[model samples]
Target: MTKVQKGKLISGLSVGKKLTVMVLVMLIPFSLITVFLLYTLNRFGNSYNLVVSNVAIANQYNLEFREEYDSVLYQMVARSITKDMINEELGLTNPDDMTENVRQSFDKLVTSSTSQNARKSAESVLKLLTTLDNRCNDINNNIIKGGAYDVNMSALDNDIRVITELIQERISEYIYYEAGSMELIRSAMEAERIKLIRAIGMFFIFFFIFVLFLVIYLSSAITHEVDILVGEVKSEQINSRNLELKLLQSQINPHFLYNTLDNIVWLSEGGRKDDVTGIVTSLSRFFRTTLSGGLDYITIKQEISHIESYLQIQRFRYRDILNYEIDIPEEFLGYRIIKMTLQPVVENALYHGIKNKRGGGTIKISMHHQGGDLEIDVEDNGIGMNSEDTANLQRLADGLEKAREDNAGFGMANVGERMRLNYGPEYGLKIESEYGKGTIVKILFPKENSN
Candidate 1:
C-alpha cells in the first residue's frame, strides 16, 4: 500500500489498540536493556563487596598479630622495663598473668572469621602466637632462677628478636596477598562501570526518539477523529432544533376547538343564525392563525389576534361569566415570538384559574420591553392555585418534573420548553399565585425573534 493509505489504516485502528501498540513498542526493548544492565551492575556490586570483606578480615588478622607481638616483647624484656609493671627485671616474675593477654589475641581471629580463606589465615596466625608466648614464658622462668644482675640480658634480647621477625614476616605476607586481590577486583569493577555509563547514554537517546514519535502520532490521531465527531454533533443540534419546533406546533389547542364546535352546534339547534355565523367566523380565524402554514414564529400582532379569536369563542360559551382584555404597546406588536407560547398560558388562566371561581373573572394579557428582554405577564383575577400547586406548576414549567403521559399537565409545560429551546435557559416562565386571590404568570423572552 501507498504511505498515505498505510497511515490511514493505522489511524483507523481503535484507540485502545493504538495505545496497546504504542506501549509494546516503547516497553519491550527498554525493559530488556534495563534487565541486562541491572544484572551486570549487580554482578559488579557483588565483586566489589567481596573485595571489601576480604580486606576487613586481613586487617583484623594483622591487628591481632601486632598486639600479640608487642605483648611478647614486653614479656621477653620484662627485667629491662619497670619492675613493678613487668616484675622480671628484679628477679620477681608472674608467668601465668603474662600469658593471659597473649591468649586473648589468638582467640579473637578464630571467632570473627566468616570465610574459609579468612579462617585458614587466622589458624596460621594463632600457631605463631602460641610459639611466641611459650618463648617469653621460658625467658621469665630463667630470670626467676638467676639473680637479676647475673642474668644474660644480650642473649635474652637476641632470642625475642628472632621470634618477632617470624611473626612480622607472616603478617606482611597475607596483607600483601589481600592488597593484590583488591587491586585486581577494583580494575574489573572500573571497566564494567564505564560500559554501564555508555549503555545508559544509548538508552536515553533511544527513549527520547520514541517519546517524540509517540507525542506526534497520538495527538494527530486524536485530533483527526475529534474533528469528525464535532461536525456530527453540530449537525445533530440543528436537526434537534427543527424537531423541537415541529413538536411545539403539533400541540394544538384541542380543548378550544372541540368546545367551540359544540358551541356552534348548540347555536344551530336553537335556530340562532346570526350567532352561528359569528362563532363560525371566529373559529375560522382562530384555526387560520393557529396553523400559519406550519411556521414556528409569527408577529406579536398575529399572536394577539389569535388569542382574541379564542376569547371570542369562549365568550359565546360562558357569556357573562368569562371576560378578557389585552394591553400591548403598538411598538412591541411588530416583534415576533415562538408560535403557541402565549395561548397555553392564557388557556391555563381561563380553565384552571377563572372557571373555578365563585363568579365571572377577567384575564389580562400585558406586554412591555425591559432591558434586553420582552416581559409578558398573563394575570387572572380568578380563584388562584394553592402554594403546592404554584410550586408544582413552576417545576413543570422549568422541566424539573415530568408531565403526565396523557398530556394532562402539558399545556403550560409545552409553552415553557418552547421558550427555553428558542431563547435559552435564562428565558422561561415565573408563576405567582395565592390560593383564593389570583395568578400572575410572567414569561420572559429575548427581544430578538427566533427566526
Candidate 2:
C-alpha cells in the first residue's frame, strides 16, 4: 500500500523523505529472516529432543535384564541364595513387581516414541517380557517343590536364558533404532535448513535490489521536482527584476532636477549667463537619454552618451572639484546594454569618491574587451575606502545584499542587479579600492552582437 512499494510516481515527495521509505521497506526481509530462523530452529529442536527422549526412556533396563535374570536363576538352583537373598543381593523385587516395573518402562518408551515402527518394536518387547516372567516364576516353583536339580538347571539354561537373551536383543534393537533415527532427523533438518537459508537469502537479495531501485527512483523524482521548482522561482525573479529596473528607469530623480535648477538660479543671479545656458543644454540631454523612448535596452553608444550628459551637468555644478572622461572605443559602442547601466557607477564615483576628497579629483571611464566579455572600468582618484568598507560595498554591487534607495551606493547596486538579472550571474560589477588612494569599478558584460 506504500507509495514506494507500489513504485508509484509522486512528484511532491521531497528528497529527504526518500530514505525513510527505503529503510522501512528493506527491514521487511531482515524481519522475515529472523522469524524463519527461529521457526526452523524450534521445529527441528522438538524433533531432536523427542528422539533423545525416546532413547533415554527405552534405556532404563537396557543390558541389565539378561544378566540379572540368568544370575537369579543360577543362584536359586545352586542354593547359593534364597529368594530373600536374591532380593538383597541383586536388588530384585518380587517377580511380578519386577516384571511390572520393566513393562511400565517399555510402555513409556512406546508412548514417547515418535515413529510407529519404534512404538511397535517396544510393544513386541513388552509381550516378550511377559513370557519370560512367567517362565521364571515356574522355575521358582520347581525349586520350591524340591525337584531334581537337572529339571531346574535344564530349565534355567533352556527357557530363562533364551528368553532373557532374546529380550536383551529386542531391547538393544529398540535402543539402537531410537539412537540411529537421530541421524535421519539431523540430516533432514540440515537439508531443510540449507534450503530455507537459500530461499531467504535470495528473497533478501532481491528485496534489497528492489529497495535500491526504489530509492534511486524517488531521488530522481525529487530532484526533478526540485529542479522544476527552482526554475519557476528563477523565472518569477527575472520578471520581478525586470519590473524593478523599469521603475527605476521610468524617470529621472526629482531631487537632481531640483538641485540643478537651484544651481541654475544661482548662476543666473551671479550674471553667469553662458554657464547657465551650457548647464541647461546638458540637463536637457541628460533627461532626453534618461527617457530613451521608454526602451529598457539601448546600444552602448546611447548608454555612454547618457552617462556623459549626466556627468557633464555634475562637472559644471562641482566646477573646481570634479573632472570626468569617457575613453570607450567607437567600434565597441555598437553593442547593446541595459539603459542607465553606467550612470549609477558614474554617479557613485562623483558623490562617494570625488565629493569626499580634500582637493579636486578625476573620474576616468574606459572599456576593455577581455575574451568573451566586455569590461568597462571606471577609475576614480578620490578619498577611497578601507578594505572592510570596500568588502561590504562589494556585496551590494554583486547583489548579495539588497540595495535600499537611501543607501550610499544604491544606484550602483541597482545597476549590478540589472546586469546580472538581464544577462547572467557572470555579468556584474567588481569594485577594487585602496584606502587614501583611489577606487576602480569594473562592469562585466557578455560581448553580444549590437542591437
Clashes of each: 1, 0
Those runs of model 2 whose alpha carbons end farther than 4 Å from true positions after fitting are 1-252, 449-451
Q: For residues 9-57, what per-residue lDDT tens digits would candidate 2 score against the true structure?
A: 5345566666566677676765675576567657756776776666655
Q: List the residue pairs that clash in candidate 2.
A: none
lDDT string for model 1 (1-451, tens) is 9999989988999988887777778667656755765676567456545544544444454455444545544554554443234554535344344334434643554564334444554565556556655756655556656636324243243334444444444444434443344444445555665574565556556666555465445435534553453344344333322321111243565766788889889999999999999999888888888888645579889989888888888899888778998999898888888777787888888888888898979999999876878988899999998999899989988867645424445677767765664567788999999988999999898876532
With candidate 1 superimposed using the best TM-score fit, by how many Å does residue 314's alpha carbon deviate from the native?
A: 0.9
Task: Give me the overall lDDT of model 2.
Answer: 0.71
Highest lDDT against the true fold, candidate: 2
| TM-score of candidate 1 relative to the true fold | 0.45
Candidate 1 Cα misplacement greater than 4 A, ranges: 1-250, 253-255, 405-408
Q: After superposition, how far is residue 389 of candidate 2 from its true place, in Å?
A: 0.9
